[model samples]
Target: AQSVAQPEDQVNVAEGNPLTVKCTYSVSGNPYLFWYVQYPNRGLQFLLKYITGDNLVKGSYGFEAEFNKSQTSFHLKKPSALVSDSALYFCAVRDGDWGSSNTGKLIFGQGTTLQVKP
Candidate 1:
């Protein structure tokens, strides 16, 4: 079975400090990893994705992620945290069993709440 794990339920960081949210995935074939951000009562917005190629992928809002194939991990990172950036983060994976025809259906982790203190 394919799955994703977000080890942390919440991450607290001071504004202007670096922030990271961890994620790990399990899959059979090549994994398509993605990160999404959700604000209060809103749908998740795409942050970044690791489909192929580069291990270090830059994303929206000055955020980036490193795809480590050996470790089976894709962790989201930001150089500095902002109060505005404090929101729910989700790590998602496209299960290959379902294939690309139905790629919209994503298997998501429980999600991590990011709290940036000013």
Candidate 2:
């Protein structure tokens, strides 16, 4: 079965400093990884995805993620973080094949809280 894990329950970073939210995935076939962020009163917003092509995938709000096939990891990163960037982050994985039985069903990791201090 496919699964995702965000080992860290929370990540702390200072304003203007680099920040990372870790994510690792396990899947039977090719892995489709994604990152999402949720604000206090908003829905889960797509951050980035690794379906194919380059290992490094860039997404919204200055966020980027590198898909490490060897490590099965897709950690979200930003060179500089803002206090406003603080939110709940999620890592998700889907089967590489779209025709699979669980099509469009993503296995999500435990939520991780990102706290950015001003």
Candidate 3:
């Protein structure tokens, strides 16, 4: 029943400009959110997470996310984006349905392509 949504199919930003990839989640209980980035021909790399604590959580590649409990959102942001940063990004949440046997699984969003143009 829980789901994560990346409303945009693609996000375009000029190289050196700030970039953002939107993410919103719907689930029961405290949300365990995560962000991942994937370059072409490369596997998804863990970017950041929002399991608990402060609203803002920092991660790899100069990226960070603000966990907004009121908005049910955890959008990924980078102050400045590079051409190399262009890639597919995903937002996911830990499936906490312990009742089910498949625990520790992450329910991911549809994914958003980030295009940083020089």
Q: How close is candidate 2 to the true structure, as a TM-score?
A: 0.95
lDDT of each: 0.94, 0.94, 0.92
Tens digit of lDDT per residue, candidate 3, span 2-54? 89999999999999999989999998867889999888899999999998899
Higher-lDDT candidate among 1 and 3? 1
* Residue 100 accuracy (lDDT) in model 3: 57
**Model 3: number of clashes?**
0
Over 4 Å off in model 3, which ranges? 95-102
In model 1, the Cα lDDT at residue 116 comes to 100
Query: Which of the two candidates, 2 or 3, achieves a greater TM-score against the reference?
Result: 2
lDDT of 2 by residue, 37-98 (tens): 99999999999899999999999999999999999899999999999999999999998866
Which stretches in model 1 have alpha-carbon errors above 4 Å?
Answer: 96-104
TM-score of each: 0.93, 0.95, 0.93
Q: What lDDT is reached at residue 52 by model 2?
A: 94
Q: What is the lDDT of residue 74 in candidate 3?
A: 97
